[model samples]
Target: MATQGRSTLDRRRFLGLSAAGAAALGLGMAGSAAAQTPSGASRMPPSIAALGPVLGKAVPIADDEYRARLAKAQRLLAEQGMDAVFIGAGTTLRYFVDLNWWGSERTAGVLLTRSGDPIYITPEFERSRAMEQVRFGSEIRTWQENQSPFDLIARTLRDRGIATGTLGIEEQLPFFMADGIGKAAPQLHLVSATPVTAGCRAVKSEAEIALLQIANDATLACYHAVWQALQPGMTQQDVQALVAQAYGRMGVRGFVDINVGKYTAQPHGSIEPQKIVEGTVVILDDGCQVHGYTSDITRTFVLGKASDKMKRVFSIVQQAQIAAREAARTGGMMGDIDAAARKVIADGGYGPGYKYFTHRLGHGIGMDMHEWYYAVGDSRQPILSNMTLSDEPGIYIPGEFGVRLEECMVTTPAGGRWFTPQSPSIELPFG
Candidate 1:
């Protein structure tokens, strides 16, 4: 059975040692202790305590950076002969302002034009919070609950001299919004502007990478804490609650949609009501989101004693993960990187059906948990340096068990670097 507080004690000791060791190495204590620890910890990680101060000292994106980004967008619009880029949706809003907002209401949106500063059309209730954080170079237009935000958006476009030309729309725009915009402004042309946004977010600056590193470190702490707390009789939901509680205590927000899965059920099935039985293969696919950045991790564990089949499956998946990691070079073919692991499983006689894995090998992770860049089923895009992605491949035997292993990796010239160091062992119910 997994021991509660075992890894938490280790984490506390590790942070203490890290601080002392850093001083011994002629380097000052760096990063937040809390941010450094993962989601499920009894004690705050050293990084969380230290990160705020360190990050404060660290260089932030200058005002010029945002201006430059806006300028680039403008250049793209000019090249396409468009007057404005109609950006809507969560990801696009965050990309432009780096501000976080709730998706509860329809009042949150922005209409960016080449001629004026970005126009923010937010709900009456959230306008206060939006104005406090969101930076709009020009005028901000607010829409009340009674008024349609899109209607105001169209009216603003007309008043600001933006009509009769191409309007760039985010790929994730709601169908309703698309229709409304078309009806409101019939002469306007809207095209998918995903490529433009992707180009801006694909390349991570040093500051962005540091934030990600901090988030990853914190998530690892949470993962270790949850594993330490796991018990044989606990249900998957219990473990999930425990993990979330651990994260909450440490002042870290868990992923918006966490995947706390059990390998005991049929493939892709929901967690059953029964407690996690001994010999069950359990996997916790969760992450901690910090400062709008996310860390995705998955660990497969056995409840009590590991069976021979469990060991074999874990070994195969672990080795396949290694192969996939090795193939992801800075300039290598993405298809090759994906094939490395799939080939391993296919050669192991599991075939590509149940053992083949259901989802793609991995996807880019940053602002969004699942971004556009992919490793599998995408043959053309090559791996680029500084791109962070998850490597998840698994085999699921229906009505028996589900086994999946996932870890985040950042692309580099040599290959990929694990955001968080791989756990020492995959054996569950660590004894």
Candidate 2:
């Protein structure tokens, strides 16, 4: 599907987001979720052997796109007055060059110079493997096990006539590596390269938005199916297994963080065993990925008919999420979105700040879940078009229950639009 249109969005908006088509909701989460023992499931599941591939539709990013990212990083380096930027072997390197190398005690990195092509730094023993994955770099500077990679990096910099200017290092670079580089070449000044790395990654391209849309749609589909399949006494792990099976059926991979009963108050997860009980709150918080892009969504509702108090609190949280979404504007201050959400909660008799909403309003999501441009009370970053972030606002009452409603959204000229529509209500949570 074409990723952009003006009148189509206007028509959808007028028709009501709830009435909009089902392409927006997909993908979800698991793994680091709450501890749960496998239990008697609520439904039958297909054998793992029978499940089809989850990544069948995903396409690796194009080579030309990776090259464009390098060019953008180089431009940012020049603007920031840096001679070069060292991209460590994690997300930033993957963001710029599509290489999925792991970071370790051994220093493997990508050196992107402002004046020339990118360089790959590899352990001598892994040079051939590095070439197999290397997309943008032609020069590979290899360091043997007995040799000091730090010294090699310094000498390489000096060789490139970048002996004294500031070198921008990605923020995730290990301290030992940075310290070694500093000691090896005390003449070079090291600074955080967040501006370059985040600058390039903060905004999503059209293709990225398409992939994210698919991811969110697939996961939300899993959520809808699993919620209907839920039975009254299923354990949290049972619910998780069902969600996984739904993902397998939907042809996407995902996870579900299900907190039943009183454990719903814990945000990240609960270690205590829990099960569905009458009128107890259930929170399903999670997301999924498509072609390395991700979607983060959280939906909370009661397993049975909600209490009047539960319904009231859910309405407040839902309004808070809506406030956050409506407040996002291209070029507007990022803090405005959080402030708007907080205002609704505070006005609805739930706040005094973090007393109710204990966490920041949201986080940027892409190759990583929590990335650049956080939605907090004091952030001053401007919202740019195609920048996607979670719009989750909640009220956590320690001894009682918590209510959180999150949806992934992208900034457009017309304001923020969700990858999935906000939940319909406390009674119809998945809608």
Candidate 3:
């Protein structure tokens, strides 16, 4: 739909925040997150999948969408001049097969070519579900869990007469997986397939956008619920528990990694166990996931009233966020919008350089929280309609306090529309 709106913000207020600002609210950050572990791996914390139906269905790709996405991938293969694009990364596998199962013991992959039907190679244990989800492919090959899955993949290619052709491998392929594939198919020339896949997945389709909008609405609802659940003297952990409960009740299937901080204005500081005391500035950043789509939002609040310094930082950040959002348009350079936000932060005398603003203006959010098209100092990617990203800007004034306001935005035929509601202004009670 149409994606543009004027932000109605009041920026002239400089007052104290809630002197007794203590409550649990959902808050998150805008940076690189830890690499996700394969499903059931002990190295990483358990994912929502471990929570069973509490996180939702195991259906990743299903029915019509599955067929449509595969057809799209085949088209991309032709455009990239590759005979077969190897797909094994979590994002790629999720895109093609819709299975979220993971393991390092046996590598699972697919070979999508421009001419022939698609082929899947997975461990024998996963073969049944893979067969169920992989409806359009022409061949399904399963290797025993004890044997090399890459060997089966190589056999499939050989049996299909795919010799003397370039094999497109994902840039994100694990080193171990790549080594195994190299050993199995030494005759095939391997090249990076990121460009082909990136071109295919960068622009959101109407259906994808609709799913993201639903996720956004659910996210906003969760945020408001968490705010209402807050109370003075509540620990940060308590607030996090409330976020998980609220989001779960809303049908959001995701883990709740909530960060709550007071006086600690820097974005990455630990949310300690201290009681949220009076005159504290609280930042809540949280997200809710539906299917694989996720909505990220951030809001700064005062538990009771507004403090003088808190109000100033809040207003400046709100202004910056508005400016960045409004400037985002099709064909516009991403750097310019970021520069706009940085300029505002600097003009407010928050200092003239990177010292005050430590992070990028925004980042793309999709299948994974932070995906591509980041709005950073060096990035010059132009904004495109149908792309989705976060429009987050904040001024971190070390030790003293930090203020950041953020929302997810969807680029439309006309411009960009915010997915989540505009967070409240920086002042008492954060209303």
Candidate 4:
């Protein structure tokens, strides 16, 4: 049986730990806006306790739209010469079925063939719950605890006239489960279905883009609230709790990494106690979900005032982010954006590329925070219309500090436009 908190599990899957990750995150907070506990290094974030939720619109993808996604995936499967793709209880299944299921020890998901409708697989006990959420497909198949679902899967494939053919398994599907399926059905060859799932998901549809934009906007608002509420004595946990509360107040759920002072240099950051004092640099990277679509953005700035060097590095990061955004053009190569962004960081004297400017320029962001066809150095993938990506570029000077400015942008008929405005300057990051 799927737990009632299935939605929270989905969010946790998207957001790895940071407070936002494990400890700092408080773990159980959903829209509840739980208070901080055990006061390790700090008290809770400043009050937004008086505020109410700011949620606006929320409607899941329509039935016909999910069908369209299936159509696209089918086309990709044919191109890849695969007979069917087995998606097991994750985002890919959610994307196609509009159902949120927790992957468990039992085999549960859908076996989507190259043509016709999809077959949803689940334990006999979960059939009712899974059935209620099914949007695109009607065929439901179930197996008992003693039976191997893998055998059922083989039977289904063979029933669909796929006795001996290729099966594209979801890349994230547990290898043990895939192995079980392969062992049960030796005649079927299994391959990575990334070309099917990521191929369909990498590019956002109009509805997906709208939800993504809303999610990003809400995340920005929460970050803005955190910045305004920040005080010098505040601990990193304090700010983290504040962001969580603010997200609840705004009727959105998100995860944020509040890196203070030198802690910002480590990128994803440390769990050590951090207090925001005068001239302390902070990096806030976070995102929230709108109807299951995701939004991610990062902004870096100084607390009271920035030193000249801090400002310089911040500017360079801001410039690198902008260069990456502007470099995105339809029909162009994906690698170009990363190169353009890296050039700005290198030219700004933070170069010796990949040394100080660690990590890729950006990544595809939509459903998954870091999706496929990333904007790493020299990727040969061509830019496509309505494809969404993050233009995040940073300079991390190990012992000093790090500055990363990120904005989620979508490829359009023209070029690319950010879901939210890029931080203009260190002095006025929100501007």
- Give the top-scoring candidate (TM-score): 4
The lDDT of model 1 is: 0.62
The whole-model C-alpha lDDT of candidate 3 against the native structure comes to 0.64
Better of 3 and 4 by TM-score: 4
Give residue 6's error in model 1 in angstroms.
35
User: What TM-score does model 4 achieve against the real structure?
Assistant: 0.89
Off by over 4 Å in 3: 1-62, 255-263, 428-431
Residue-pair clashes per prediction, in order, are 28, 15, 21, 5
Q: What is the full ranking by TM-score, best candidate first?
A: 4, 2, 3, 1
| Model 1 lDDT at residue 83 | 76
Candidate 1 off by > 4 Å: 1-65, 78-82, 104-108, 123-130, 142-151, 158-161, 255-269, 353-355, 428-431
Quote the lDDT for 122 in model 1: 74
Q: Candidate 3, residues 341-424: lDDT per residue as tens digits? A: 888889988857577877888877777566666766756787788788888888777677777777888765455688866776
List, residue by residue over 48-124, the lDDT tens digit for candidate 4. Answer: 55445644576678888888999999999999999999999877788887778988788898888889999988899
Give the alpha carbon lDDT tens digit for every residue of 119-185 in model 1.
Answer: 7777777777777877656466887778887778788898888767778876666777877787888
Q: What are the per-residue Cα lDDT tens digits for candidate 2 across 161-191? A: 9889999988989899999988998999999
